[model samples]
Target: MRSRRARVAVIGVVVGLVTLAGGCASTDDPKANPSPPAGGIEGTVWVANEGGHSLSVIDAASSTVVTTIEGIEGPHNVQVGPDGSRVYVVSGHASTVAALDATTYRLASAAPTGASPAHVVLTPDGQRTYVTNYDAGTVSVYRPDLTPSGTIDLGGGPHGMRPSPDGSTLVVANLKAGTVDLIDTRTDRKVAAVPVGGPAVQVAVSPDSRYAYASVSRPPSVVKIDLQTRVVAGRAEVPTAPAQVYLTPDGRSLLSADQGSKDKPGTALSVIDTATMTPAGSIATGSGPHGVVIDPTGRRAWVTNVYDSTVSVIDLPTRTTVATINMGSQPNGISYAPRPPAPAEPRMSVVLPSPPAESSHGDHGGHG
Candidate 1:
């Protein structure tokens, strides 16, 4: 759906591979106001780096980086807007969706979508903003202060997307038509599709969203769906191409992130166990593993290899990997904001760039 380049030639390998995971993440509630104190981290994680066309803000207590925000180009997935103060990024070479300002990182508006947005979803009272559009299958939506609010035509290659923690529904995955669609967020329409597997690149739910997972990158499985009888209730192989599935702020467990076997690229990380959803172990990490966060004290988990630019971290009760952190280029998407970056000034403008040399790489809408 997109590939024009020059977002820093590919911001260190497409922002470490479009990472994302947030249905709510904070941890040690001393009343909860953690992060940023160690060095930096007042909410903001959209990394993609793609060699630095833009997007970098790190500071998660000195993880570093802290600044870098430009429009969008080869960007890929990154979300945080919905009143958390904006961040939505998704640009496979400017198909468009920028909208920054997660506290002065800057930019603030872009929109255009419908070719390769690849992923984005919001509406827990942040108003609305869907995006998706992999190669023009379509999805647009908008309005959390950005406007638009229209488009919706999916099928074929939509990539991993979620929304159902009682928000009404909006699931989508459609990778090459393996299928998922399901829309309806209060009558935006569509309503059904459901197939799954063989391609489904990422999708997660379960904090009472009633279950809905999907990771299938060609037989390297993890399908399970049931969101109120939409169907396809089974599947679970994961080890190779399962590119992202997050969920575990207590919802039990379901982490996956495989990126392996593209000629043994394998680095692993599986983990399942959602009350017997199966496959409870795998670990290893760091090679090309693309996106899979978990900080607010879920014990640990950072992952973001994208061809070893580095980031493993992990630990979570001995899942392993302990520390890696090299983070330079090709490190796709990853986000977090238990709180940290609003001391005034910075409002958004972090520019880091200088990596690119790696390479690159969602979902939503329609059913009728």
Candidate 2:
């Protein structure tokens, strides 16, 4: 049973939008599953403005808002495909997941999921997409074409999910269950569940895929779990309420966007060293930093501040915020896409041997 507020939120999106398609497909059908694109479009950050019901595209280099896509109902999370061809957005209020063209930012397709589809993550291979249903206690699986493929039951509030770097496993943070569900993507089934003793908000797997770090809100800590043993390896203290956690590209540092206390209003990002399992330092961000994503180069990090309706760009090496860009109302979700480097200009074959010979002879005469 959902609360009245939750019910109202779910109902709000249904009023004026077209109904999403509802159907399921077999995972083994080759025609139903297409391989992900080989490359992705780079140099843009996509953000989900939950309150504004829109998506904001920001130019990574200039830190400017390129565009704001309207008409999305409660866009709670946003993710770009590995190849950068498509963008996926989860509308919790609409109970739907919509796919948009990565370059044009137009709606490509959409499909309904369980109640309160909160977060979405695509497989590294880009063949599949997994979405966590916050209130339904389930995860919906979709093919690359945005067709619903199947569903996995977790019996808890499934909020945040991430696939391993190798695409072998999917780690889901069950917010209400206070446990982490590990799913083997090969079979698309839950293989194990580890209790973390608090409500889990987000999960980030190591680059090597050996461990997964989960942010626990109740005790204000992040728990490290050994993927092989399926047990709690260690824990590190964080801020009062950590909304999202992500690992750096090098897997050297784990960053948490701590949404500080309501009275205090948190504006800090907690940095944890993976080796020591302790807090290394904290970088100040905007008010209510809820989501974070690191650039492909690992030099800069972008964080969405919900309360302030802005995004803070952090310089990782200096551990300081370099700029803050104003976003729409309550920007909650963010993702990074690496832009392809510009092609090098063609070089002209200049004949400089005659000049060099003259310079050599003249320099010898001057020395003599």
Return the top candidate by TM-score.
2
Encode model 1's per-residue lDDT on 1-368: one tens digit a residue. 23432221232132223222210121211122222233222344456644434455555554445444544444646777656677777666545676677766666666566665667778767788887766566677888765777987875667668787778888888776777777888877768888874557678888788878888766677888887888977787875666777877887888887865323566877898877778988889887677787755676666666665555666678788655555545566676666665543322343322222321322221110
Q: Please list the Cα RMSD from the true structure of every candidate, rounded to 1 decimal place.
A: 17.8, 19.5
Query: Model 1 residue 324 lDDT?
Result: 59
How high is the lDDT of residue 58 in model 1? 56
The TM-score, computed over Cα atoms with residue i paired to residue i, of candidate 1 is: 0.33
Candidate 2 accuracy as lDDT: 0.74
Query: How many clashes would you count in candidate 2?
Result: 6
Kindly list the per-residue Cα lDDT of model 2 for residues 1-368, writing each as its tens digit.
46424433332222111111110111111122222222222488888877666777776766656666777766778998999888899765556788887755667877777766779899999999999876678999999988899999998777788999999999999877889999999999999999998878789999999999998876778899999999999999986668789999989899998875434457898999988899999999987778999987788888987766778888888888777777766777898888632222111111111222211111000000
Most lDDT-accurate candidate: 2
